[model samples]
Target: MCSTLPTEVQNAPQIDQDSGDTIGVLDCLRLNVYVPNKASSQNPLPVMVWIYGGGFFEGAAGWYDGSYLVKHDVVVVTINYRVGPYGFMCLDIPEVPAFGGDANSITVFGQSAGAGSIDLHLYSPYERLFHKAIVQSGSAKVEGMFINPDYSAAINIAQQLGFNTTDSNEAISFLSTIDSHLVIAASSSLGYWFRPCKEQVFDNVANFVEQDSQNQYSPARIRNTPLFVGTTSDEEYTYDMNEFAGNPFLDKIKTHYSLSDADLTRISNTIRHFYIGDEEISSDLLRELNDFKQDFHFQHPIDRAIVKYIEQGANVYQYIFAYSSDDSPVYHSAELKYLLSPKFDPLDESNKKDLLMSKCATTMWTNFAKYGNPTPESTEEVPVTLDRATVDKRSYLYVDDENGNLLPLTSLPRKYQNWGQDRDWNRGSGVGPDDGVRIDFDNRTVVGIRIDSENG
Candidate 1:
């Protein structure tokens, strides 16, 4: 069975000169390619590049093993770019002349910081190499701008470790002189959450926040490629370390915002207004903290980008991961198991059902990569009224409850609107300390209910 599995590796060529001195030019230019052993002869296998995300601080090409996608008849490419301040920091260096070359029609995909990089590549002045972009669990709103203090701290730390960042001519040159680990360590101390600073306008791609509606750098003109955006059920669960409950970072945030004891009670409110399209923070007290984190970081930001893409008349699709397990902590990257293996869970029939849902997800994703649409009915997942140019009927894939069940994306809002008619429905009845907000169920109302009495 192991010998029957098929995969091959290749290197993609870079058509540009290395101006920065941080990493070797050969290392900076090389990209790893995972090819299918049994590619369709009539139509060369569609490509799906994976970009691993570690908050822009940690991750490498080795982190993602693309054998699964390759076995499914897709070419997977993972490339290494300069990371942290070295990869992203702008030093106002003179522009190098563009290497003359034709572009390839490819689809770029990534999660977290990788997702932001996809967005950046789409808008880069250098001609893009991809025809579609799949941004998973990352949005430009938070990633579009870097905090000035964080940037300064990163540079200062790099210098302390003896890496240069000041002189444009010597910066990339000196970077190549130092060990990779040292530069990474110095950048890590300043924090892994740096974004491109909006105040210092560099180029259109780096200046994501500065690009306005009227500006040519908007997402509408950023890329003429198909788009796929998604997020995990609980994106931040992995980051919650109980040991750091009283960490200095929390104290610093509280002081910066002047947060009082009462403010913690309404922390959701601040997060909502700041990130969730000004949606009202749920008034329910139970589980407010979890819901707030979900809204600001995952749900709200992803939703905003999806809507924006739809309004622009670009091809798009929206999805929510509703499958989870009672035994598993509802945390980030939990869905990876479902995608990587058929037997991700086996203890119960419910786990078996989630396996089916995982199949539906992979099917939709591969279908979109091959056809430029998730399904035949929709090229983009946009709102009804927001779509004005031509009626591009949008549909969503809802892997609901158990099994590979799917429903129209619009059914969520319809279910919400009609919940009052159901006699068993109660909006605020089960409200409790951990129940979070009591609300009518739509598609977004995902819960991993415990069925076993022993677990209960």
Candidate 2:
């Protein structure tokens, strides 16, 4: 009954488990609060806020349920924020007030695009908003989400609605004056993406993004609270092998980092060589293709954020979710089946082991919310103690490789460069957690972005 931003209400590829109605609204900024029965005014429970991930274009609060998590004796808050253009316009607008909660014990967590947003908070001055953050398979830079206002989307989208102008201010003005629905329709028609653009920060700028995490990575500016990072063994564990032939995401990356033409070609060759070596890109190289997609889309960006987190002196707890129902490969966002449970889980049929994993993930997450550490003490469900990943040794907890047994935290080989077989997720290896999370194809093709301000 409230208002959401001017985005299509449905999530991209759809959250199959979310049986809620999908309708776009404008004024419904809501906080779906789930408080444990034990919580009272006198007794404030540790708060964990859920941020849905839909590539900054899709997602809704109505699709998620926090009741399963509240059973763990924590206050769960599912938030709704302005997305697409409304969310990231960053044009000197009044700041929207977030839900008021126990600030000291707040832990923000999300997956994919949601995880990317959580990672962004670490760079802002408002790092104090949450005492801790759990980033799942994403960071601010994931999927080339952040950029300067280099694209002509304002003019192009306006032109779609019968307004043609090259002036940025004028185009924006025309866009602002038109019916919001008209703008949305036009944007949808031309595949315009209104993403978070890196801004030039100055004195008295209200809610402006100053620098990118890559160019302006300042460890001193971030709040080094206890951080938990989760990654599925493969981003998109299973896919049509031929879909990724010669489709390197470097085109998007070329624009994201503003690479030159010469540099682009050189980097592309190097990357393509690494992924497929001298072999031509085709259906035959499914494993290499998956690796390339996984690295470019998820792990590399997350790895960048991890390096930044470590540099900031944050107590970082990294996890690789490898549990599969039949001991097969687990796909991207696979842990969500365990983390959200019952509802919000696409896999309707859950085995006893799945339920156990649900307990393990929920307990671990809620434990981190209550106390910075995930495994302060071993429980029946989670018998293994998790160790923090450090600068010298990048050790992280491997979650439930065995269907029933919680695997102890183990040290991964110093770098991913050391691994020869990156695609085999189920392979038992001393280096890495078999495989890290994979990337999605929809993220690249569905969401269209300008490669450069001039040509693309």
Candidate 3:
């Protein structure tokens, strides 16, 4: 167990705030490396780089302890990258230096916004720095994930900071003089408005727009990188629904997406029919809303990404984390506690199953890091050797305790079967092997849904 001193970068800009002076960018970027007690540089074990997530606004490397993963004979690295406006403001600056390591044996993994960062890196010119990736509950294709050519939010943030100039260059110059803490404070208040933007070149760093135009998982970009992507069964169980309730929420959606008044009313009615049919906003309705949010934000985008990778002939593994305690029942980021921490108590009878599940998950993760496949060897209880995801198979590993082992799901879930029905973007298009109904994207509600006769 070895840790490095946090070394500040030279020429780092400072921001002034009421609290104190803070660096515009986190100058004290550090990488904490952990290796097994028996391992050494000569042996050169496989490396797993963990990126933490806090909605792209707040997160730190120190939050995650990789000691448990290191004990599995792999090198675990937790790194610090800039977050919010300072990190992703689309400014012309020196590129964030890459970590020095064996690029061939590196696997980059992260959860939520961290996962989104990995997606950006995967499409970056520096993608060759890592060999594989694991994206947990996030994707670049998700709506609003990448802010393309839209400096309005950033300009708004600067104006809020009392830098009212409209000229991009002048505003940026003034912003550089402000305190970093104040900038972050404004970003927090603005929410997801300040995030990574597309089409911007920073010191020749690959911009997101160019990469996104091409197939994200194509061999041309990713070079057939193996990927493990998944989401929790109840990813949005903890979501605060106040943001999306009532007419104001509808108005915001309409304005943001440029949805017409007619389209908004139609979509609202459809949403009500699917998620709140004949029910008040009760506990059951909340559950439905949670599922809808999860599916729309995390699950659907991730599933689409996985399918794209498979289509591009890249090795991919998909999973749905269903293991949860009786109290929490599979909330977002719940898997992190189990996978990262070794303090899982075996004495607690209620959590015994979770403890076992954690061990299995860790083993699979490390195995994938070492080898391209997750389950290279079969376990005794389940005797399951998980298959590589393919366009034909579309196989997904369902991680739960019911069978005490990984179970393969070949068919699309019922909810996902008609996924394209309500989606205005992918309307009139069929996904997977099934010839499902194709609906058109129009202003009218209840767009014609045509069921494939063969499947029906």
Among the numbered candidates, top TM-score falls to 3
Pairs clashing within candidate 3: 15-179, 15-180, 16-179
Query: Which digits, one per residue and each the tens of the lDDT, describe model 1 over residues 1-456?
Result: 011222222211111123322222224534556565554334456777666665554445544555544544566666665556655554444200011111243577877777866755665555555677877777653313233324344446557676657654555566566666566555555545445443345454344444421121355564345787666655554334342243222342354233345443343232233222343323332133354345434554455455456655666766555556454444555554554331322223256555454555565666667666655443222111111111133355444554324554542222111212112334211111222232211222322111112211
Candidates in order: C-alpha RMSD to true structure: 11.5, 9.0, 5.8
lDDT of 1: 0.46
Ranking 1 against 3 by TM-score, winner: 3
lDDT of each: 0.46, 0.63, 0.63
Pairs of residues at least 3 apart in sequence or in different chains that clash in candidate 2: 2-28, 3-27, 3-28, 4-25, 233-436, 234-438, 235-437, 235-438
Q: Candidate 2's residue-wise lDDT over 235-276, tens digit each?
A: 765468545534464654464444456545554554555556
Q: Considering lDDT, which of the candidate structures 1 and 3 is the better prediction for this target?
A: 3
- After aligning candidate 2 to the native by TM-score, how far in Å is the CA of 188 from where it should be? 1.8
Once model 2 is optimally superposed onto the true structure by TM-score, how far is the C-alpha of residue 381 displaced, in angstroms? 1.1
Off by over 4 Å in 2: 1-23, 90-101, 150-152, 163-179, 200-203, 221-223, 247-284, 341-344, 347-350, 401-403, 413-456
